[model samples]
Target: MAEAAGCPLSVIVPALDEAAGIAATLEPLQVWRERGAEVLVVDGGSGDGTPEAAAPGADRVLGGARGRAPQMNAGAAAAGGRVLLFLHADTRPPEDGDRALLTALEGGRHWGRFDVRLTGASRLTLLGLVGAMMNLRSRLTGIATGDQALFVTRAAFRAVGGFPEQPLMEDIALSRLLKKHCGRPACLRERALTSSRRWEDRGILRTIGLMWALRLRYWLGADPAVLAARYHRG
Candidate 1:
């Protein structure tokens, strides 16, 4: 498919059994179209009708490989846009997110991510604290996660050899590669709203603690397979 004129940005959402939430996630892309952005949905062998759910809102929907990293790579390959956004199926971009991405792209920022926030009230305060910590950490270390809704120029993505086809920590791997290529990565003011399902399932405090431990282990060179087996959902 062709890209939008002037500003070429393609948002890719990877889905796996996301029929219930895919539409909500894609709704904001309708606004993005007005700001000269294209939306592509990559389905990871979803048993549910996720493709149909995203078809109406997305500019294109392509069947993807099983894993998220591979699926995102496939989506990026199909995309004709100069800027590629890697978004999760349970995340929603801010109202001005599209404009912010284009502005960053124009400003020579090859790689960046939006701030992240979680939905729901059970752990609102805790989640806010976590969000603040994440922002601070990104500023200090130049690491960005998938949940934050990362975006990068197609050239930069290709330079880093695209995302690794791993079952876990692919976001961290890509973020490190991006940081190596582009120092002091940009951070957009727009926030991506993410689902709190994991927090609810694992309990907020426990989940947060586990994430911190995982990060520490990763930093210490622990095997990602072990961490993935311990923390991965579904």
Candidate 2:
């Protein structure tokens, strides 16, 4: 891991049709912004006012191609921070997340992700199990998903050539690259609270099964475009 003593941190969010949650998502990050960190929102051709809604909380809101990979890459390109944290519109990092990331980096980690907590209005007992399983799986596999709030130093990110511009599994793809080049990530115990709307709306067990199937297919060298289409259809 490269030394990142004085480089500022940047929180990069990729959004699309996220008007309802954009403000809430960026709100907590305002404290970090005030402390010299920058927050950038890259909108992926949102029909709703996601970009406008994000402007108040973000240092800059820019338009980009309609995909998480592209939008996030755009944000990274424009970001001024030496360390970049990629956050989803429906996720919120734990309090003092900036310090946590910086501390991890200073301890010699090039890239890492937080443990995730899935939350929703529904009373789903299995949600706890799901989150636990996710954390454990990431620890074992050295593969972190987008929901976990992935962060990496600028040098490491550029070395991996950023997230692969794939239709699906871009997070997984980037994780593999990073693990190959920079070694295993620092698995922070502090959780990033991620929305469980997908699981709740799509049925928790069904979503789990689908995810496993998708992952298996992806590992089997299936086309990401087809997998993405299948994911959206579900």
Give the whole-model CA lDDT for all candidates, comma-separated.
0.86, 0.93
C-alpha lDDT of residue 53 in model 2? 95
TM-score of 2: 0.95
Q: Considering every candidate listed, which one attains the maximal lDDT? A: 2
Identify the runs in model 2 with alpha carbons over 4 angstroms from their true place: 1-7, 121-124
- Using TM-score, give the best candidate's number: 2
lDDT of 2 at 202: 98
Task: Tell me the tens digit of each residue's lDDT in model 1 across 140-212.
Answer: 7889999899999888899999998877789998999998987657898788899888987888789988998
Residue pairs in clash, model 2 = none
